[model samples]
Target: MNKILLYFLLFVGIQSFSQELNCNLVINAQQTGNENFQVFTTLEKQLTEFVNNTTWTNKVFKPQERINCSMVITITNKSGDLYNGSIQVQSTRPVFGSTYSTPVYNVNDKNFSFRYQEFQNMVFNPNQFQSNLISVIAFHVYMILGVDADTFALKGGEAYFQQARTIVNYSQQEGFSGWKLEDGLQTRFALIETIQSQTYKEYRQVLYDYHREGMDQMYEDVKTAKKNVADAIIELEPMNNRRPNSYLMRTFFDAKADEIEQVFSDGPSVEITKLTSVLNKIAPIHAGKWRSIKF
Candidate 1:
């Protein structure tokens, strides 16, 4: 009996140690002339600490049980931009395992200086500002072409995005100003705006292709899938509002939620199919100003 117990303990220890998340994370970092991507020595250490020490288990991730994350950074000194790179992560559980890998083939160069400056200013204390930026960048990559919500939310959302927002807002008050949103808004604002990928429109076509190729469609029910897509779109609108849009697309919503639900009908794919037909017969006129402010 004692021998059996000892063996069981060994098995558990092996499993725990083997439960590592591994992947390559490449940063498309570059610099101009003499300056280059200089990851603060501390920042590099903190990232290592996060992966090696955190309890990123099944509770933090659903549909999978363990996670392995790895990264490689490429810094170009002449251009001060991220030319290209990639990251890969995997998760495993007792009976299941999954992996996610993304290519940073394109890096939005909207805020090169500000971004690098932020990284330069970072220290080794695990401050909220530094932590959030890391998360924001990771989230951006995931948003651009990420297919796994479960992994993203579990791995980065709470630890980074939610906390990052607080840090960003705090950096703007009576005592702060260096971290400005304007400089990075073009590429970075998507997180704030919550825009869903426009790729969702291809759902039906993807379904047809899967059928043609003899692959299984994850959602067998069309209506249910549509509803889910709609919900996802609605969720994106609040975040999307932080960015500027075309004129016509800008007039409908009084609040972010209203804009998402009413104008877009909580679905990103539902384009305005009958805008001309709906407005053709009526002459546009401004309404009278409210005689009194009435709620």
Candidate 2:
């Protein structure tokens, strides 16, 4: 090919090479009493490759455009090669006009049970019923995308959410613990469905407002942005009364407790008091912080 054509192709190749995720994957097996230390170390390296090497979506990404996220997998037990553990997955997105990135998804799944062998190839097939490990990891990967996308646009992550739903659907065939609604409120099923549910339409908008309209504006103007954020927090008040610690409410506060506290601490007293009252009712676990919101 001509030099110009070759360079153009190289540019496209490089751009397309950037995966959608800039994930920091950590696998901890300190609690896996029976597994060999080398086995755990190899598994951690294998998992890092499985996560970082795979391209989770069709979107072409610039290296800098890749979403920033972290997955820390803690292996708590091992019976032969079968493992039981917890995986904490969290992702953050940049505020439109600032260098600051804010958390979009922060969840620690306790029911993350799976099987693994040292150096066994880790593969993920979204449409097929797969091992619990691959399915759970892929579920969170898509969710990180879905959550971040929703912040950029109103329900913009529909396709990503559907992909996550697909994983959950196929996971049902595997009969995994966290894939079903009966598994618990904190299961993977509840998180995806709640975001996709028409019954809680305002939930996604609240996400969008908090990130796009609120955080995006913070760099340019803090006063107006804080009001927008407070307004966004109030949007959840009605849902809080209806659902009263529903799946979404809990996850929302889980990812946002610290950020919310800081955002309202600087606003006008009246607005801060009103927003804190609403926040205090919804996320009472952070009652101390919410209650302490002051001018």
Candidate 3:
């Protein structure tokens, strides 16, 4: 009976802590007129297994606690084993005391090019650069984890972001488009660098305040929550003044424009004249969305 009880406890423990990300990965190869659909299908199946099965962090998360995310890789061209494509990554977190899941990270990476063979094993090694495919996917995974953590706690995503930075460092020597500083202003290097820089510290703080302190409290006290959310947006104005039209700022609004519009469109009513103005100045491209916000 003692041995049986010990085995049962072990089983329970194993079941309790599972993989962190519940990612839905899709491989779209319609643009590649290759009649060999089997390769793409197999690649999708293996990648989906790799992403969903790999344990991303030291912290243990229950099944339901897993971060909800999606990755769509659109293969634009194929030449034998070489593939050129783009990847769209998006992640969301559930709001406290509510059924709604709020978008946290959403961006499209256009520099995804890699070599792959059908049924090739996809493995991730953080300490070393394995392949462009692995490094790119792992980098985005950490970014998703980092942003999600920031929403829950102030600077909570530091460790995850560092992991992403490590991947960037290791990948730079491989001459990939998104891994180096000269790749472009909006490359993966820039995204991680800007997020970790002390100059843009307020961005992380806004994430915590906007989500944990504001969105999480909506079900309990909506008026106070709206104010908190608005204050978080206002906090970005100083940062915007210092660094206008930043890549990070654009990335933030890309994931949040619709949600921000909806948040102020209908609520207990908080003063948003300044809020809309600040948003327009910082993110002029989103002015149309801001205009739709009801006063």
Candidate 4:
């Protein structure tokens, strides 16, 4: 009887301490050599615990309310303590009054390289540079939060975005490849900066409108919901015209590509035509998908 009572209390204690992110993490090392492979297993376990158990923000979140996201790390090569890999980070948030959780972030980082040792703990210090593994993980965690928060409230993710920016700032001196401006368009620094830029403020507003005013209203009022989504998609035009396939622009299309196609599959011809035009100009890579939208 005492053991049962103790177990119940422990379960309740764990539930009470839930954090903002409910991240599902997976690390694959099959590509790397089989030598000393046990370290990768330890690394995977540590990363899962780090992302799930750590408290990131001051806001308390109930177990069900925690944000849902996933991170998959695939190691391509290893030399001594250095490991080269790719990180695929994806996240989705639940629409109000519905069971659907729309995608908010989808990014594939090919330049993710880090160093790890067997049973070594991953540490992240916001004010200083740490291991590339922890630094990159922390950066994406905050980015996921920022994107999710912005979907619900206009400019609601400023704090989270700022946290990401700080990670970038602190990480720049770490000599990591992805933490630099010259690392190309798909780099981490470029995307976070684009999110926080004043010039793209309206784009953030569009995110809130698209998710809250748009997706949440689909079953109840798709016509009005479609209009709201169209407004948000069109909002991408100006930013795209200015930056011409920017990191943020590209990330948006990456995450919403399927959602856009599904939502507009049965949309009106006029709406489809408008969306097709905008998509062609902003993200021509998905032109085939956009063109398939039925009138």
Candidate 5:
């Protein structure tokens, strides 16, 4: 009877602490020109395991409930154990009562330089900087979590964003490029800092309003949902006026431009005269897409 009770408790605990991310991690070393592909293969396998198997949050996530995301690490150069590359991180969440999934976060990190001996253990130590490889991947994982959470509830992702911030703080001492303010405007340092700043508070609020209040409601009320989504996006104009062509704004549109075009083009027309003007003002890079919005 004691053994049965112990087994029951253990099973419950396992269910309570399931991993949160279902990630499809790809390591593309085609440009490295290393005919010996064993190291790249091994690195891909180990990193996949490291990311998908690690439990990220205290909240329980069942297998199907895990956030759907992908990370592509493109290795551009290799010198001994040092590797130089870029990483593109993208994540999406399912819209309620629909078969569609909406893109939530997407960013390409260009300063992905790291050292890894083949067969090196990929462990994530949040309180300490383990390796540039681990820290970079872990940092983006929390960013994905934070952005996904924010879409569900207003500022719901704060705890996860704070974790990403902690990673930024811990990783700065390593002299890596992306962990510092001087690394350029699009670095991880700028991304997380912009996200948490009250000056850009509308960005996070739009994430919630666009997803939970807008996309999720499309099945029930298409016109109202489109208006909500447009209103949520237009709210960013004030922030753009303050900080033009900001990293967060670019990141938001990078993931959302195509979807936005599609949504506005096909939908029951909400008055978008103001929306088009706002889009051109804030994300002019996507002007071609905005122009293609039919109605």
Candidate 6:
């Protein structure tokens, strides 16, 4: 009897140790604009509702007491344009410490969920930073839009621009790190400036001509190709449903397209490439350095 009682006491002690304080965390719905406010308020409200109203783990301990928990909520208003969401009470309490461990989970970007290939043609037309991500963007657009590539292309224009602008702004601020927007922008800027620096201005003329005349056909061809790509991807959707999130079929198709396009791989003029290379070399120093220049 004493042994059983001892075991019971130990079980009760463990239960007591694990007992969580039930607390109400209220976040003003209007405070959604404030970054900190958004995160914390959403967390508290969602977690409270999740824990208090419903039972998560069905297996109960000997004494049948609720587990003690601590929660934190965070809200970021700056990111409100991109995401509006709440963090649920994301924690589990063992018979232990007071500190609540917050495991972070990312919100899925709407861009990622959309047809990416169609999204690309719209953003990359001017060959800006958005052009740098043409391949990946095309792949995503194809995957998400599936059969509705043309419709997705038409509707996704604004979203593609917004997302592209965001990425470009961020990369520029961060100094063109890695293969992101900053690097692409810097490369384009160097190419343009090198042409502009010449005494003859032939390079500049070529660029102007390329922009005005050459780009129209290029745009039409690329757009048409993208539409075809979208159609191809839509055909692959049944395969995705079969495999779920597998890009193998889409990638194979894209690779084939790229191989075909490689026929036009002959690059810009030797003089232009040389001057651009020089500009890019010195670009690092001039990237962040700004002095008042008289126009």
lDDT of 2 at 212: 76
lDDT of 3 by residue, 72-115 (tens): 99999999899999999999887776657788999899989999
Candidate 5, residues 1-295, lDDT tens digits: the string is: 1221122121111121113799999999889788358989899989999999998788766787788899999999999899999999999887776556688889999999999999988888878999999999999999998998888878888999999999999999997789999999999999999999988989999999998788877767778888999999999999999999999999999999988988888747789999999999999999999999888
RMSD of each: 16.4, 8.2, 8.4, 8.1, 8.9, 25.9
Query: Clashing residue pairs, candidate 2?
Result: none
Superposition TM-score, candidate 3 onto the true structure: 0.92
The parts of candidate 1 lying over 4 Å away from their true place are 1-23, 27-63, 66-74, 78-160, 169-178, 187-190, 193-223, 230-295
Write candidate 1's Cα lDDT for 1-295 as tens digits: 1221122121111121223334334444433233233543443554555444444333343222233334544344423322222222222212111121111122332332223332344332223344333443433333322212222222222333333344445434422222354544333343333322343222222222322211111123333333332343333233334433412122211111221122223222333323212221111121111111111
**Which scores greater on lDDT, model 2 or model 3?**
3
Against the true structure, candidate 5 reaches a TM-score of 0.93
Clashes of each: 19, 0, 0, 0, 0, 17
Question: What local distance difference test score does each model get?
Answer: 0.30, 0.78, 0.86, 0.79, 0.86, 0.28
Flag the better candidate by lDDT, 5 or 6: 5
- For all predicted structures, in order, the TM-scores are 0.35, 0.90, 0.92, 0.89, 0.93, 0.20
Candidate 3 Cα lDDT to native: 0.86
Worst 10 residues of 3 by lDDT: 8-17
> How well does candidate 6 match the true structure in TM-score terms?
0.20
Give me the displacement of residue 122 in model 5, in angstroms: 1.4
Model 5 residue 133 lDDT score: 96
